[model samples]
Target: MAELESPKMMPKSITFLSSLLQRVADSNDLHREFQPQKISVFHGLTRPTISIQSYLERIFKYANCSPSCFVVAYVYLDRFAQRQPSLPINSLNVHRLLITSVLVSAKFMDDMYYNNAYYARVGGISTIEMNYLEVDFLFGLGFNLNVTPNTFHTYCSYLQREMMQQPSLNLAESSLNLGRSLKVHLCFNEDETSHQQQQLAV
Candidate 1:
């Protein structure tokens, strides 16, 4: 497999994405405080000391995935939240969710990506736990890993719009509506590795 040739430095869009996700996760955590959702494999025993932005920056620095993977990872996160109401993005699970989503996105969307072991080290989890997280996340998403060009562009546009209208952006409201209209195709054969890598035009 050919290595991805993108620059290793974090992109500006990643900073925006991190901020947006942090806000969403924080909002969800506050809401779940009273409701108390069920804890699953994604949830950590305790919230990581590191902030979401810093964790994401760490992944960007080491994962070597293209910036587009972050957008697709966001898409996967939306789908997971929609599919699995029990496992919403909150303070406890947001970091793990971000790492797994980005790892899956890189595997599916990039021509080259690090293995689960490498991703595990980057995510501050054991390889065994990372494998479990990957499987659970895939099932949570119903194996809908493929993102259409339209869906990708829609998310990109949404992130860009949020960047411009940060003050007025209602994180919860916007997050709830994201990917609602975008169609996703499911892939059932997990062993089938062939994927057409699409270049994100954003």
Candidate 2:
């Protein structure tokens, strides 16, 4: 496993959600990147090999939450780390913060079936702290919670629809290949485009 960045990074965070509020009031800056219609969203960062680049990413592997939650959680975590670097936190506290952040984001962004009250009750944190964390998270993500992306289910849906038309491609490995092919098929002769292709190809 790749070593994770230490929780000490929390202190290095930018900590000014209030100051940057004007820059991303609606967080349109972040939403411009999320494309829900695409297929095989994280093909390069396959579930089996994703690194702990973000607290949410690290916890999702351990928590078994849905992809929507992961997406919200990751952006929130990154934005928080980006903004408030002085907050004192260890790995455990960071995970707790991420869990609270994920639940809060999910509630706003998706149909999270889990009960927020139940999670907070079970979580070993004060309700006040949870509320504070949520506030920080909202400010970090520029108060924007809507995060949609191309998902595995979308890819499966595309494969099924295509298979119905062709009636020949097997849904086993061939479907996987189709997903891979779709990603690899994008021509990227430019340096920046090539770099993006490489990142997604990981």
Strongest candidate by lDDT: 1
lDDT, candidate 1, residue 33?
A: 59
**To one decimal, what is the Cα RMSD in angstroms of model 1 from the true structure?**
7.7
Clashing pairs for predicted structure model 1, backbone only = none
lDDT of 1 by residue, 17-85 (tens): 888777767777767756547889888898899999999988988898888999899889878877876
TM-score of each: 0.80, 0.38
lDDT of 1: 0.77
Q: lDDT per model, in order?
A: 0.77, 0.40
